[model samples]
Target: MRIQKRTAVAVAVALIGSLTLIGAGTVTATAEETSVALPSASFRDIVVDGVHDRVFVSDPTGGSIVVTDYAGTVVQQITAEEGAAGLALSADSSTLYVALSTAGAIAEIDTATLTETHRYPTGSDTSPQNLAMAGGKLWFGYTVGSSGGIGSLDVASADPAATLVPSGRYWYYAPALASSPADPDVLVAGEEGVSPATLAVYDTATGGLQKRAERLFTSSPSISFLNDFAVTADGQNIVVAANNPYDHQIVRLSDLSSNGSYSSWQFPNAVAVATDGTVATGAVGDFVKTYRPGSTWPSLHEYGVNDLQRDGLAWAPDENRLFAITGFSYGSAPTLHVLPDAGKLDTTLDVQAPATSRKGKDLTVTGRLSAAEPFPAGTTVEVTRTDAEHPAGTPVGTFPVSTATGEFTFTERPRGTGDITYTATYKGDGLHTAATSQTTVTITK
Candidate 1:
């Protein structure tokens, strides 16, 4: 395996085989972007297992899934089939499902052990390109010999079966697929080609068509494709990455009506929605732009990452981090970029106790969690105690940060003597890193 870092210009030039400027348009770059090198030359998709604190990248050419931590550190590499194109994490985050396009199979990798435990045949002559998990099943899209469609497998069955969705086929490319997080039974499939593009919603349980929207890109005469799309966690909005013109379109799921359209970047290939309702779009180069729920303009804060064209983006709400897979096209090497929320956090801890108190006397511990502003109400802080008897220390209690003052306090009595120490920790939310503070008190005979 090889690892090397390349700039946006270098990646773009390498991908196009020359720096002749493939497109007539230009993207605005406001700040510098950061990037981490990967060991693979080709990439297809990215997924984050926030519960396990790991990011997975599918490298179809390398036939491996590269795993990294929230810090972008390479932790492990699991060998896969020749064409490991799409990836999806189990709802519980225990198993990672990968589509082996060339092998015509899907493999399940144990997230903890970083090993492949099982493989199931997709039973399709065409190669599968995208994978989604919903309704306790693994769904995939495939295209071969001018025919394409969607298929799914029951994840819970002892002997899973691959069943094609009724009337799910298209004339050309496999439609891009996304499932609603709020309602697993709801799915959105989009088709992009020379003909008029189309979008359809399906009910996974009954295999029924809920709604279909055609003529997605009415203005573009050139071939159009659905580069990427996502459904808001609340199941209220569907966002699509319309390529030819490089526009983002939001549609209200309730009525299949266009909510709004925002044209901010040139050729955005990936888009994702956070649990907090923030929308992120990954364009051809340098930066990932985020926007507030109701606003079409970019957010005040932006995540700058390498110009390597991004193909997939996933948000890990637990860590407040975004995982992006780069180098989708061209001969450029694939890279995984881990971007944490942009900002700094401040925290403090204090102790109130006699310098030399009785062994069983009560002691008070207090702390305040602060950043640019006070944290949200009901935020939690962990308290731990350490003494000579138990040098390793033990978690004693947990307290909530006050909404009004950002203060948290708790009382405890020392059971043993000899320089007891109290420590408080705030496990940073989506916008901050974990911080800790400690104070010591002595016990008398």
Candidate 2:
């Protein structure tokens, strides 16, 4: 078997090069980047508690969990049992459940107090990997000997019993696991190893398997483990980050079929889907990029942070913020990044033309473009003309805006009488809404 591969940096450059053909109207949104260093270099998972305005990071090697504020400020560090790897937050965001691999137990932490409040033992030898909160219970994947499977603990029930889903010999202790936020009955799991990776969907309500798909990489030995995967808020799409060329695959949940695949600038270690249908990817070297589903081209929003060791990405809908965990790779220090939601731009278009002009005479059209933030100096604006003869309008021409004053001008000779409408439009960047302005001029014989 032959395997195809390309470096993420080269792909990003090619994507950027292609943008020039789409005209200068497209602009990349700028992000304010801030980082908070962690005491330990080794990090596993990260979760956000919107209700408490805090973020939690698991430091397995340090045997501690670091807590930070929404602004990426260190708040506190709470000690945990050894091998604290995966983390899950309760529905109300009041309690955080942690998987202590070495201790073979799940520990619960109080958000306000930042302390371990309770510990539930899974078993003496089971090593839990990833955790999810669904069906009013805590679902986790554990590896025992050569086999592993999914298990759940009904935290809501008075007894809170731990039970494993009945499945034949399967590798349930995969690196990627997620539960649908909209539907508690849906759960996604996958196996990451030298053998072909298998992705499966389970119906938690019936403990029945819904669907499974196999992903075989020709050169599997060279590929590392699958790191990040997310289920869309609507529970309709599953995004998985796979190695050996470092690409993201989107799968439709209804039929478990491939929807699309995307290339990244770096190995995407973490991925997340926003409530509003935005997909964010955090890769090695702190390269973060976002895209709209089903689009062939990448969006203009990208963020870069120095010495960012990619780990996990989490979205906080209530606060409109993205929290990214960086560290545990490339000999870089562990840090947390806080990126605020993209900002909106206010745009205005002004058109100037003679009130009346003679037929066959030059009709000079001028316009100025302004926005909340300064746009690229020579960005292009499209112009169109409509007259009584051709009310539908026809392309006049495309002129580049003046870098000095954000103004554009075009001269056209009239050939017909009656009113002529000249319109100037700025087809907005993905981050900002587009704007249009027009002015009418009367031509008499």
Candidate 3:
């Protein structure tokens, strides 16, 4: 009952105040955020349909799916289902599958028409909460009274039905599921509502489910209480967000080994991976951060918000923008924030120079610019020199990087004595984030 109220004025003030706060590190990019008030107070999941240019948000409490355009304007609201929660879109973005928790079914909505054409009943009182599509099947996490399990609905079947997976009975609540386009046959699930959560990776190739690996976070106290997690685009790793952890962790999907993490504020509760392998992680601390694939360093972009709800993050198929659902406070209408240009690749810049160089002598400054995506041809890095004389820094030269190796080198004569700092900055282009690295050298007689 309380979830039906709206506080547009208070929500608007919170959005404006959040804009003035820096969400992450020094290199965080500024994102223009546009928020649209929603009809629901409680939300479960978000999915973006790039083909139809629609964003769907499911509200379990309201028992409906709120559909919006790329601009966050509500185009339609489908209330044919009860307790609508998680959402998954077909590869072609033609069909949207909704998990009807109270109705115990998966509703299929024709994206173009914005109508529910069919509802495949999972069973009586299954209470499906989260959904993912992989191996040509719609996988769902469901609860039956006190127990929870995972099941799949073969959407392509003539008479589609939900078949329970026996390997999914290890949770008190329905787990969160994730899959990757790169490895469509691989599915990953993390137990929800359970501290010291257990994560299981499944091999669903050929439409068969088999457990490949699993890990219980009991060994690491920081990893308890799973909030949200995602399988990387490459399907080689799983990025996890936990309540006790101050960072989102990247772990191998094979053995669940430690890989890397995207460090951020505490209470990381939501995460999503873009088609381009860019990872967007959100925390209730009111920040959403994006990291390039496989990089544990600082994020490429971080945007501030009121508060990112659990399972609140989704990226458009084109990776052009990100759609986030916020506003979990009581008596507030949920706000959909559209973040433009939020999927840029991250780059690393390293500048190396001789430890000592003779005054007025030639010194070579060399380094490399590395990124998951290749740099454009003829990419150049701007180099600067800073010392006691040029405290503000002086332009040394613009050096070109070997596109093949991302390495760049330039020669500069040391005119200023004492410790001279050579700073190499890659101004970055549309595809990559700007990176800067510095190395110091002493100038001697």
Candidate 4:
């Protein structure tokens, strides 16, 4: 076992080679994107367990689950039942659940041992396609013969208990499922393989599916050929990706009302939300975008990938890494792409002052600290004065910026003449990058 594991690791690293960041837009100087070629011919789902520092990729075609370290180094490939497809991790991440579509059961694996410990059967001929754990149950979207629907397995129950929700029988194909820890009682499902796909939000607080809100996209801001979707960490909004929208749609989970959308390249296909409220979206084309919560614009770190698979993105809980599966072309072999510092949103700070001013006069200094997300209330920007006397740049003042606008203004008196420069600096917060901008003012007698 030791020798085989060592060889597998070596082969995985060799296949990874060295990847260079290409076709990036506003990526931070320190951000690096890496890729590792997988041994599988196809991919169905990707899940990251920050607790274990492991990434699990399910391959129905290979009937296996490929495991890798945080750096994309192959750790082990656990053989699963036939048709290993959708994957979900337990809330604690100690256990991983895999949906075996052909076997009509869910395989439970101990994450630490990388071994299949149990197989819970859904039913004969019931092919589960997607899995979501919420409300203390393992909910799944499955197909029974010609019709498809959703079901759940009671993980806490002593017996292998499964319930096929009767309300889910109306779908043409199996839907994709998503849930959030922030809202533990909510489960979201979207229909597959159909235009104007039906999306529904369910309340699982009662231990059974109760329809909360449903939408069929036939009106304005229409969606078609639903590819993937996700619920925000706070469970307040659902992000949708469809073939016709040309961008990811965001809506209130309460009423299914349009909240906003994240604009992306053609063919928006995948969307994932980090625990820290960072949103990562993918497209079939070259670009993938990450946005801070409630921001319509892609964060400054939006970068490009070759071609992302449908439902191919996942984020580490700490936001340190983003895992994406990509192929050079449709129906080709896929590779796992790991982006380092995936949560760092770049910021912009600009200082404005009078172009010309007289010595001993007060000047209005104005600036804005721009980021993917708004700064909180009471956030301040530090200003420094640089003139003939203070070339080292003396601290002038720190003023609060508008929480809504990120704009700030202050008054400064220049004692020295000649060209004076005012520098505005936003030191950055946990998820944002520091930024500095300066504007010079000529001071005369």
Backbone clashes in model 3, listed as residue pairs: none
Q: Compared with the true structure, what per-residue lDDT tens digits does model 2 show for residues 139-236? A: 88888776777778888877675676654445735345788777787777767653445666776675443444344333422234666778877788
Measured with C-alpha atoms, the lDDT of residue 99 in candidate 3 is 92
lDDT of 4 by residue, 1-445 (tens): 0000112332332223212111111211244467889988678999999889999998898899999998898999987558999999998999999999999999999999999999888987899989999899999999998888889999988886778886543888887899999889899888867988788989898888899898888866688899999999888999998887888888889988888888876888999898888888888864677766777763535656777899899998875578899874766668988886667655655566666878888877666666555676778878788888888988888899998766688886777679877777777666666667777888877
lDDT of each: 0.67, 0.69, 0.79, 0.80
Please give the lDDT score for candidate 4: 0.80
RMSD of 4: 11.8
Clashes (backbone N, CA, C under 3 Å), per candidate, total 1, 1, 0, 0
Question: What is candidate 4's TM-score against the reference?
Answer: 0.74
Per-model TM against the reference? 0.69, 0.68, 0.73, 0.74
On TM-score, who's better, 3 or 4?
Answer: 4
Ranked by lDDT, the better of candidates 1 and 3 is 3
Stretches of candidate 1 above 4 Å error?
1-34, 193-196, 207-215, 219-223, 298-300, 328-332, 342-445
**Candidate 4, after superposition: displacement of residue 275 in Å?**
0.7
Q: Weakest 10 consecutive residues, lDDT, candidate 4?
A: 18-27
Candidate 4: residue 189 Cα off by (Å): 1.3
Q: Lowest summed lDDT over 10 consecutive residues: which window, candidate 1?
A: 22-31
